[model samples]
Target: MNKIYTGILSAVCLDGSPPAYHYAKGFGEGASNWMVYLEGGGWCKSEDTCYSKVQNQGPGMGNSYKKGNQTAFDGILSPSQTMNPNVKIHRRGARVFKAIMEDLLAKGMRNANNAILAGNSAGGLATILHCDGFRALIPNAARLKCIADAALFIRGKDLPGAADKRELSFATIVAFHGIDNFLPKSCTSKMDPGLCIFPENLLGDIQTPIFLLNSAFDSLQVSSCFFQNLLLELNSYILCIHFRTTLLKTIPEDHSSSRGIFIDSCYYHDQIYFNPKWIGPTSPKLNNKTMSEAVGDWYFDRSSFQEIDMENDFPRDCTRDT
Candidate 1:
């Protein structure tokens, strides 16, 4: 893993602090293609929530570039200097992303022919938020795409009570993070920036090809589709069904061939980036294709594609032991 210290970058995180992203230089043929992944933990809805977030992350939001020590990185940031688990600081996502790209441009990403800007969970949402910016960076690239994993928070019919509270959270986030200032002006102009932050509103403005990767029964959504007050537990199944329908409908059909979607019945959040879920004989199979093969085929334009799993055919519950 190539570590680009935040101190050398142009942007600082929300707290006026520096945070680094774990970067891996592509190899061989892969060298010409770039993959920039955003790390996601969750979001900060209020000033207090933001403060609590820093506290939870300890000094330097887990590891400090100021310390001059190789703090461990995991998940997609894994196989690094060491392994240590830490919570993510959400408000800083967009800025961290901008800085990462600036450093990559200075390296050799400018000569790349293809680039995949992707992330899972919160990272997935960030991929959508920053997709346009990334495309602008490589205006001459032959192909540039965005992949959102389990971050497509399914929008649906009027789900009152808890749903209203969730909307409130969105409002808080927009103000807390100054999301309106950077969001697509057209989207925020027509509606609240809080609502504009959703892919449902921003998808139309994104000119880049996008791939949506999610689970029919996303674990994270089932638990907290709303706030702690709206814990649906297992009964959130209804919500998932409606949300998927809305997501499928929202994707642009104009350039249908350029778009791709993969949703399985597995009860998991982010899968493709993790080894067990990506590939291997024992991995979760969708039409005899592992996550890696499906993504490769779609991103590389190897075949026509769109996969959705039903509960009856593969009603398999995902267990960590698998």
Candidate 2:
């Protein structure tokens, strides 16, 4: 674990602990390439929940003290050129990102040839929220892009014209975290800051190239909508269908060629960090290419991948052991 011990950057986490990240330097042709992955652990929308997460998850989640001395590089961080080809925290996550990037810039990332910023779940949402800013940080890199895994959290319409409970939750989080000040001005200027937390609101303004990896039937999102809306078991199937349709419609129609998307039919969430789901035998594929392949191709400009699995309109079980 590389802890940031320099100045104010040291105490950036919610608990005022030093924020840290694990680094695995590259070799050969991969030396100039950099991959910055932001980890996800669902957010705490209230102070009570924040305290609970700090206690329950220990220093590993928001504090660097308990982090391991070393961690194996797996999944997208794999060192194998054949496998990886390339390439957390806090209620104060926005600050954590800044500290990590500053540390990297100081430690030789300024000469990076190519760079990627990626994350899953809440981290995925962070990737979306911080996409353009991350690129601006490494303006010298020849190529820079972002990847969001299971990060698309929409303010879904569980019932016709019903108030969206999910939006309210996001609003609470935004207000609690004091994140309105950090949201993109382009989005906040046009809509409520709470809405900006949703990728649907921020996607249009992001100037950097990005690859989106999401399950069309994202299990966590679907379940959250079901329970929060208080839908009866008899109407659960109808809620599923409606939420799926809403998710599909919410994705913007206008996408430039540089953008990439891989929305599969699996009822899963956060696939990028798991070897089995990212590139192994059970990895979900579209156009006969796994998620890792598609992302690599897009990053290297080998091909454009914008395919969505239209094979099934509803969710299907494509679960794989990690």
lDDT (0 to 1) per candidate: 0.68, 0.78
Question: What TM-score would you give candidate 2 relative to the actual structure?
Answer: 0.85
Tell me model 1's lDDT, rounded to 2 decimals.
0.68
Error of 1 at 38 (Å): 0.5
Task: Please write out the lDDT profile of model 1 over residues 8-82, one tens digit for every residue.
Answer: 343455444566566677899788889888766888777667656565553225244343445376566764322
Best by TM-score: 2
lDDT per residue (tens digit) for residues 1-322 in model 2: 7887644544466555666789998899989999999888888877667655655554335353344345488778765433443202346666667778888887778889999999999889989988888888889999999999999888765544324577778888899888999999998999899888988888887889999999887888776644544344555566667777878777786557678999898887889999989998889889999999999999889998898888887677777543
State, as a TM-score between 0 and 1, how close model 1 is to the true structure. Answer: 0.79
lDDT of 1 at 76: 65
User: What TM-score would every model get versus the actual structure?
Assistant: 0.79, 0.85
